[model samples]
Target: MSKVSETTLEIDLRALEHNFRYLKSKLGAETKLLAVVKAFAYGSDMVSVSKKLEGLGVDYFAVAYVKEGVLLRDAGIRTPILVLHPQAVNFDTLIERFLEPSLYSPRILKEFLKVAEAKNQKKYPVHIKFNTGLNRLGFWENDVDWILKHLNGTNAIKIKSIFSHLAASEDENEKDFSLKQIKSFKKSSSELAEKIGYQPIRHMLNTSGILNYTEAQFEMVRSGIGLYGYANDAQIDSELKPVASLKSIISQIHKIEPNESVGYNRAYKSDGYRVIATLPLGHADGIGRHYGGGNTMVLLNGKLVPIIGNVCMDMIMIDVTGADCKEGDEVIIFGGNHSAEDFANSAQTISYEILTAISQRVTRKIKE
Candidate 1:
C-alpha cells in the first residue's frame, strides 16, 4: 500500500483475521462470538474493522454507545450490535437503529421500557448487566427480583442476554475473585431465567476471561482486546500478532551542544553534544504528556532512541546520537519487535491505553 502522510497507523487486516481465527479456535462450534468494536475498534478503525469482521461471519458486534452502533448500521453492517452502555436519552435512537442496549441499572431498564412501549415495540433485544464484582455498572444481584417484578407484565422489551464483567481475569492473584464473579453471574442469570420463563444468552468473559476461565464461557463470548491481538499474558501475547503499527518519519535532524535545554518547560537538558531527530507527530496523536522527557522512545531504523523532550502537541524530539539514522528515515512509535505492550510498559501503563490512545486524526491505512 502507498503511504498517506508523514504519520499513519498501519492496521493489518490480515493480522486481525488471524487473531479472530485464533480466538475462535479456543471456543466450541456452538459458542457465538461478539466482536467488541468500541472505541473505534480499540483505536484502530471501527468501520473498516467491523466491515471486515462482518464479511468473516462474526456473529455480533459491540460498541460502547448508541451512536457508535448507528455508525456501523449506517455503514451497512447488518450484524446485531450490542451497545455496552446506553444513556436514557438515546433509547429512542437505539430502538430506531435496532441496537441492543445493555441495561445495567433499574433506572435505565425502566426508562428503556417506557421508550420501547411508547414506540410500540415488542421483544426488543436488551442485555442485562449484573454487578458481580466490577461495581462500575450493572444491577445488583439482590435487585434481580426487582427486575423480574418490573418485567412481569411488560411487553415493551425482552431479555436478549445476561452478562457481567470479570474484574481481574488477567491477574493470577485475583483468580479466586474472578471465580466468585463467575459464580455470581451464573446464579443471577439462572434466577432471572426462572422468572422470565426462558433463558437468554449468558456470557461473562472478556478476552482474558476467555483464556483464563474457559469453563465459564456460556452461550456467547465477547472478545475485545483479543480481537485486536492482546491477551495480557506473555505466552499468549507471543501467539498474537500486533495489528496496529504507529509509524512516522524523521522530519528534521538537529545537533545540540552541552547544557542545552529542550522543549516546553525545559523538561530535557542535554549533558553534552548530542544528535536529535524531530518527528512531526506528538501528544495530539495520542502520545500523552506522561510519555514525555525520556519516559519512552521511538524506533528509528530498527534502533530504539530515547525521547529527549516534552511531547509537543504536534511533534516530539528524540535522542539519536549513536543511532545510524537521519532525517526522512522511518520512525516506528510502536509496532513489530517494538511492541505496544513494551512501549506502554515504559510509561507504566497497559497496552490497551497505548493502543486506544492513538488519536483519530492519525490516518489509518489497511494493510494486508
Candidate 2:
C-alpha cells in the first residue's frame, strides 16, 4: 500500500473477507450471517463494503433505516435487507424497493400491514423483533400473543424471522443477564412459532453474542463491528484484522516556547520548548474535541505522539517533539499496528464511536 498524501480512509477488502470468514467459522453450517452495513458500513463506504460482502456471499444485510436499505437497493444489492427500524411514512418506498421491515410494535405492525394490503401484496416478508433485555426496541415477550392475534387474519405479511438484540454480550460480568435474555427470546419466539404454525428463522446473536453465546445462535447471526474487525474483546481482536485505516499527513510544524499556548483558548501550554505538528483533520473529520488535551495519541513516523490542546474543526496539533519526522510524513490516526480500539481506549471511548463518527467527506480508497 502507498502512503496517503492527504487525509484518507483506506479500506482493506481482504481484511473484510478475512473477518467475515473468521466469524462464519464460529457458526454452524446451517446458520446464516447478516452483515450490518448501516452508518456507512460503520463509517467506511457503505456501498463499497456492501459490494465486497455481497461478492463474498453474505447471507443477508441489515440497515438501521429504510433509506439505508434503499441506498443498498439502488446500488443494485440483491441480497435481502432487514430494515432494523422502519417508519410508516416510508413503508411504501420500502416495499417498492423490496426491503424487509422489522415490525417491533403493534402500531408498526398494523401500519405495515395496512400498507402491504393496500399495495395488493401477499405474504410480504417482515421480521418481528422482541425486547429481551435491550429495552430500546422490539415487542415484549408477552406481546407475542398480541402479535399472533394481529396476524390471525392477514396474508399481506409473513414473519421471515423473529429476532432480538443482546444488551451486554461483550461483558462477562453480565453473562447471567445475557443468558436470561437468550432464554426469554427462545421461549417467546418458540411459542410464537408454534401458534403461527410455521417456524420463522430465529436469531438473537450480534457480533459479541456470536463469540460469547454460540449455543444460542438460533438460526442466524448479525455481525457489524466484528466484520469491520473488532470483537470488543482483546483476545478476539488479535484474530481479526481491521478493515479501515484512517491516515493523514503532517500539514505543518510549529515551535512552541515555554509558557506559550497552542490551539483555541490556550488549552495546552508548553512547559518547555516543544515541536508540534498540525494534521489536517479534526471534529469536522470525526476526531472529536474530547480527544484533545493529550488524551489521544497518534503514530507520527512510527512514534506515538500525544494530541495537544483542543481539537479544532479542521485540524489537530500533536506534540511531535524529539521525533525524527518532517512535514508530509504520514500520520496514522488509527489502523494497521495501532488499532482503532486502542486509540478509542486512550480517549475512554469505544471503537464503534470513533469508526462511525468518521465524516463522509474524507476520501475513501479501497485496497484490493
Tell me each candidate's RMSD, in Å, in order.
Answer: 1.1, 0.7
Q: Which regions of candidate 1 deviate over 4 angstroms?
A: 1-5
How far residue 281's Cα lies from its native spot in candidate 1, in Å, is 1.0
Q: Per-residue alpha-carbon lDDT of model 2 for 1-368, expressed as tens digits? A: 57999999999999999999999999999999999999999999899999999999999999999999989999999999999999999999999999999999889999999999999999999999999988999999889889988888889999999999999999999999999999999999999999999999998999999999999988899999999999999999999999999999999998889999999999999999999999999999999998999978899887999999999999999999999999999999999889999899998999999999999999999998
- lDDT score for candidate 1 against the true structure: 0.90
TM-score of each: 0.98, 0.99
Model 2, runs deviating above 4 Å: none
Top-lDDT structure, candidate number: 2
Per-residue lDDT, model 1, residue 216, is: 88
Cα TM-score of candidate 1: 0.98
Clashes of 1: 0
Q: Candidate 1: worst 10 consecutive residues by lDDT?
A: 1-10
Alpha-carbon error at 348 in model 2, in Å? 0.8
